[model samples]
Structure formats: C-alpha cells, structure tokens
Target chain A: MNLTLKVWRQSGPDDEGRLVRYEIEDVSPDMSFLEMLDVLNERLILAGDDPVAFDHDCREGICGMCSMMIDGVAHGPQKNTTTCQLHMRHYKDGDTIVIEPWRARPFPVVKDLVVDRSAFDRIIQAGGFISVPAGSAPDAHAMPVPKVDADDAFDAATCIGCGACVAACPNGSASLFTAAKITHLGLLPQGQPERGSRARAMVEQMDEEGFGGCTNTGECTAVCPKGIPLDTIARMNADYLRASRKSG
Target chain B: MTATIDRGKATEPVTQIPSRPRRSRRRVSSNSLKAVMAVSGAVLVLFLVLHMAGNLKIFAGAESFNGYAAWLREVGYPLLPHRGLLTLLEAGLVVAIAAHMYSAIVLARRAANARPVKYAAKVKSRADGYATRTMRWGGVIVFFFVIYHLLDMTFGVANPEGHEATPFDRMVAGFDPSRWYITVFYVISVVMVGLHLRHGLWSALQTLGLARRYPVLKASAAGLSALLTLGFLVVPLAITFGVVR
Candidate 1:
C-alpha cells in the first residue's frame, strides 16, 4: 500500500515546529505504526536528512513509553490501544496520518512527538507508592482482601503512566491520571496508613503542576489507553475532602 | 565544631521562613471552584423555580398576577423596610451569580492555558456530547437574555407599556406575536439555559461527590433542568398564542 505521512518536526524545544509531509511507496499493511515510522526514518537517514523524533519502548504496549497524537486522537483510532500497538492495517492506502506530541503546558515537547513527562513523575513522587519497610514480602493470601475491592484496585492499577489522559482531555487535566494512582493505592488494606496524606499531597502536586482542573468531560477516560474509569476522580474528591477535614 | 558554627539566616531558603498558618492559601482549588459552582448553581435553580411559578400566575388574570408581583415587594410590613425581604433575596442572588460566573470564567481560562498548542486535525466525538461543547456559548446567551429580561420586565425600558403597566400587561406585551423577534430571542435563550442546566447540574453533583455511588441522580438532574425549561417556556408560548391573554 502507498501512504503519506504528515509528521510534526522541530529542531529543538525553542524552534518553531511544522507538519512536514512525506510520501512513501510499497508500504506493508501488517507493519505496526512504529515500524512504518522506522521505515520512514531509514529513508530520511539514507538521504542524509533529519529523521522524525518520537518516543517508544517495549512496543508491545506494557511500558507506556510510547506517545503520539494520531489523527487528533490519542493512540490513533483504536480504543484501549497504545500508539506502539496500533497496526497500519487500520489505515487506507491514500490516508495522510497526522502525528503530534502531547501539547499541555506542563508537558513540554523534548523533541518531535516526545514530551518531557517528568511532571507525571513528580505527581507520582508526591504520593503514589506506599511506604513499606524493605525486609520481607508479605504473603498474598494473608491480607484477605475482598474480591470486589481487589477487582477495582486492579482496574485502577492498570494505568501505565501514559500521558494519553493529558493529551486526550479537552481541559488537558491530569485528574484521571492522578485519580487512577489514588484509587489504586487507596483501595488496599496495606495502603490505609498514608491514604489521607497520599490524596492531599498528590492533588496538591497536580494543581501545582499547572494542569487544568477536570470538568468531568470524561474525554480523558474515554481515550485512556488503559481504559481507566472516570469514577476514580470521584474517589479522588472523596479522599481529598476526607483529608482536608482531618487536617482541619 | 567550626563547620557547625555557621548556623545563620543566610543559609536558609526563603520558603523555609517560619510563618503563621495561611488560611487564604486555600483560594479555590479545582475542587473548591467546583464546590462554588455547585452552591451557586443550587441557588440559581431555586430562583428559576420560583420565577417560573410567579410567571405562571398570569393564567389567573390581572388582579392575581399584579397582586402577586406587588406582594413580593411588601413582604415584611412593620418588621422590615419597603421591598426589604425581596431586596435581601435579590442581593443574595447577585452574590451567587457573581461567584458562579467568576468560577466558570476562571476554569475556562485555565483550561485554555493548559493547552497552548491545539490539534491540527478536527476532533469529531459525539461521545463528548452536546452540552459539554455548547456550555460556554449557552451561558453567554443566557447572561444576555437575563439583561434583556430585566430591562423588559423589572426596569420596564424594553417593555411596550413600560414598568408602569400591570404585571399581566407587561407579560402580554413582552411576548406578543407581533413582536416576534423578542419572542424568538426568549425562546432561544431559554432553550440554551435548559441545555446548560442539564449538563451543569450533573457536573455539579459529580463534582460534589454525590453521583459516583448512585447513577440515578444524573437522571434527576436532567429531569429537573427539562422541567424548569418547559416551566419558563410555557409562559412565553402561552402569551404568544393568546392562551394567557
């Protein structure tokens, strides 16, 4: 199949970027989106030209390292699929795919389609993991966590720290990402110790990061790669309120 | 001992200075903005319901309608000043309106600021829904309508016979079929308000942490918004069709 690519290109963080189009011939339908990009990069490199820059690691979709805004949608046209996992078969021979990086103020682009996601890291650092002493691992069955709680926690825990929630959100709010982490830890018995502090600290960090507040538009969850539930935000609000009262 | 002897203010960061608790530091977090919206929106909904009920009195004829309008001003006789109770209520409503609009504008500005760059391609998603998209524009229309409504009804400048006319006469003159533009404007603005309230109420409840466990509250919010819309609209239609006249 033959196709065209309209990829965003910028030399550095300060440089103005534009969509540079390239026509490719004899494209295979079975190739992954990233693989097609790799082919384009090889051609550019052979022609002594600058290649398009993007982020990807563990292309099978587990690491959440890949990021792209495909055709105005996060992770392309597929639902619950990562950019790296998206195959080119979904596209037509004459399709002109548009790829962009996450455009939030907090997530500045490091290169073409590669943003500095350290803001997400800082949010997690604020209060994502439980503080457990490093000696012995606890027995899994000893806790006796209810199945419903376990299921919900697992669902929340599936968030891969992809910035798709930020990219997809109309308000560009990180509430979903923040809430997913909050719910994941807040649901477990082991996480009860610092639950109050966790919610307050993380939400404060999120606000400090300059991400817009959620308006419950639900676009974040709808385009979420992990299919993180929107109700995690409700969970976050409940936790934050409880924490504020306790502080008072 | 020598190394430890340099304990002085110069080594400290500016933020490390000890100070009193900062109460004002809690100025409208996202959740707090949402709380403000919910509280203010609740007041506005109350006003709409009461206003609709008052307008419905036109069906009872001039004496009933005019008496109801006049009675609002003379609510507390010797215990309060003239128009005292109504003035107090109006003052509260003004405060609620101010808070609601301010939060909405700030939230919208922040949302815009968060994304400096926009998508190059058109994003088509019906899943985003009609209310989410039209909220800002709908609000603007409603705000303008409120101004026009006050001029026509309360202050009497826009009405045909002026504020001196009986409440019944003003209602009839304002929504007369001959003045189709005013009627059309009223219809458009009220429908926009209905749409705004439908989304706004659900969002307010969700923001206030009430809709998570019970999904039925969302339905109720929609129903109430629709009811208020029809309540307000029926008066204008009735006037235009000569049902109330």
Candidate 2:
C-alpha cells in the first residue's frame, strides 16, 4: 500500500517544530507501523535527507519504550495496540497518517517523536515499590497472599508506563500511571509496610512532576495499550485519602 | 537505513521500578483536593434531587404547591426561627459551591501547566470528547445561570412575571410559551446542567472511591443524572405547553 505521512519534525527540545509530509511507495500491508517508517527512513537516506525519528524498543510491545501519537490517538487508531505493534494494514492505499510526539510539559520533545519521559521516573522514584530484608528470598507460599489480592495487584502491575495515558489525556494528567503504581503496591501484603508512605509520596511526586489531577475523563484507560483499568485511579484515590488521614 | 532502536538507556527506566527504591517526602497531595471536590459534588447532587422533587409540587395545583413552598420557610416551626432550616441548608450549599469551584480552578491550572505545549494538530482521540471539552465552559454557564435563576425566582428582580406573586402563579407566568426568550434560557441552562451532571456524577463516584467495585454504577450515575435533569425541566415545559395552566 502507498501512503502519505505527515510527521512532526523538531530539531531539539527548544526548537520550533512543524509537520513535514513524505509520500512513500511500495509499502506492504503486512508491515508493522514501525517497519513502514523504517522503509520511509531508508528512502530518505537514499535521497540524502534526514530520516524521521521516533522511539521504540523490544518491538514486541512489553518494553513500553515505543511512544508516538499516530493520527490523534496514542499508539494508533487501533485500541489496546502499541505503536510498535500497530500494522500498516489498518490504513488503505493512498491514505494519509499524521504522526507526532506525546505533547506534555513533563515529556518535552527531545528530537522528533522522542520526548523526555524522565518525569515518570521521578514519580516512581518517590514511591512505587516494596522493601524486604536483604537476605535470601522468603518461601513464596509462606506469606500466603489471598488469591483476590494477588490478582488485583498483578492486574495493576500490568501498566507499561508508556506515557500514552498522559499523551491521550485531554488534561495531560498522569493519574492513571501513578494510580497503577500505587494500586500495584498497596494491594499486596508485601506492600503493606510502606503503603501509607507510598501513597503520600507517589501522589506528591506526581503533582510535583506537573501532571494534571484526574477528572475521570476516562481517556487514559481508553488509550491504554495494556488495558489498564480506570478503577486503578479510584483505588489510588482511596489509598491516598487513607494515607493522608493516617499521616495527619 | 539501519534501525535506530530506542535503546534501553543506561539511565534506568521508569514506570517499571527497579529492584532498589528511594525514600520520599510528602506534602498535601492533590488527592486531598480531589476528595473535597468529590464530597462537594455529592452534596450538589443530593441538593439537585431534592430541589427537583420540590419543584414537581407545581403539578399538584396552586394550593398544595404554594403550601409546600411556604412549608419550606417554616420547616423547623417555633422551636427554630422561620426559614432557619432553609438558611442552614443554603449556608452549607455556599460552602460546597465554593470548594467545588476552587478545586476545579486549581486542578485546571495544574493540568495546563502539565502540558505546556499544545499538539500541533487537533486530536480528538475518541468519539465522546464533547463532555470533557465542555466541562469548563459549561460550568461557567451553569454558574451564571444559577445567579440569574435566583434573581428571576428568588430576589423578585429579573422575573418579568413578578416574583412577588405567589409561587405557583410566578412559575406559571414565567414559563408561559409566549415568553420564548425566558423559555429558551431555561432550556439551555437545564441541558447544560444535564451534560454537566452526566460527567460530574460518574467523575465524583471515581474521585470518592465509590466506583471501584461495581461497573454498573456508571450506568446508574448516567440514569440518575438524566432523570434529575428531565425532572427539573418538566415544570417549565409543562407550563409552556399550557398543560398545567
């Protein structure tokens, strides 16, 4: 399939960016979205022009490193599919696809489609983990986590931290991402020791990182490639309130 | 061209926390504000439902409707001052409204700061963006509408039909279809309220942590909001149509 691509080109973080159009030929329907971009880059190089830049790794989608806005939707028009995994078949011959970076103050554009997502790192740094003894691992069955609790924890742990939630959010809020982390830890008995501090610390970090507060617009979950449920946000709210009250 | 894979950076990744973790300090998290917003929203929802039920007395004829209106002012009887209960409720309402507006403004400012750069092109990711996009402007309209409603029906200033008249007669005259401008304003306000309530009800449930267990609660929120909106509008529509005149 032949396609026209309108891609955002920014030289650096402080640079003024603009959409540059490129028409490519001999595209394969079976090619993944990244592969099609690879083809475009190859053509650009042959013509001595700069190739379009985007972020991706482990193209299988687990890494969550592949972050780009395809058309309007984060990842792509396909629901629950990452950019690396999005296929060219979703588009038809002569179709036009708009590609751009995740637009957010916290995720500044580094070059083109690559925005600095390190703010997410700082939030996780504040609190998103469990602390245990520095010895041999305990017997997995000794603590006996309830099936329901374990299941809930595991479900929240599935968040890929792809920044799609932030990108897709109308307010650019990272509540879904922060909530997923809080829910993942707070649900586990292993996570109980630091639960109060964890909620307080993470939420504060999220606000400091400049992410917007959750207004329950429901877009974050809609664009989530991992299907991170919106309820994680509710659980985060519950935990934060409890923790703040306890601390106070 | 060789594939320029977004390599795993030597600087550790985020979202997926590593084996080693760091300690953190806490401030009054935004969640505190969210809780306030949720509680205030719930208060407003309860008030709307009650107000809607009170308004429906218009259908019961002049005597009952007027009696109910008068009963509201003297609810606590001789033990408490006349209109004392109503005054107390109004005081509570003022607090709730203030908190709601404050939280909304602060959060909106924070959201804007979060993403300093706007998307170069317009991106409406989903089909249902109308509610989210309209929330702020709709809120502004609703706020002004509430003020105008008080002037029209409470303060006896803006009511062309005369608020000094008995409650039933005032409502009947105010909503008479011949006065299309007033009816138009009333309809716009209610529709905006309906849209606001639709999103607000569900959003409040999530913020208060009431929505985690049952998915059906979303449907209930929508249904309840729609019912309340329709209930509130019935009086004006009926009066305009000459059904209750």
lDDT score at residue B77, model 2, on the 0-100 scale:
91
Question: Any residue pairs clashing in model 1, and if so which?
Answer: none
Indicate the worst ten consecutive residues by lDDT in candidate 1 chain A: A128-137
DockQ-derived CAPRI band for the predicted complex in model 2: acceptable
| Candidate 1 lDDT for residue B114 | 88
TM-score of chain A of each: 0.97, 0.97
lDDT of 2 by residue, B71-110 (tens): 9999979988999999999999999999999988888887
Candidate 1 lDDT score at position B113 = 84
TM-score to true structure, per model: 0.90, 0.92
Per-residue error at A73 for model 1, in Å? 0.7
lDDT of candidate 1 over B37-106, digit per residue (tens): 8889989988998999998888888899999988998988768888999999999999998998999899
Measured on C-alpha atoms, candidate 2 has an lDDT of: 0.84
What does fnat come to for each candidate?
A: 0.55, 0.67
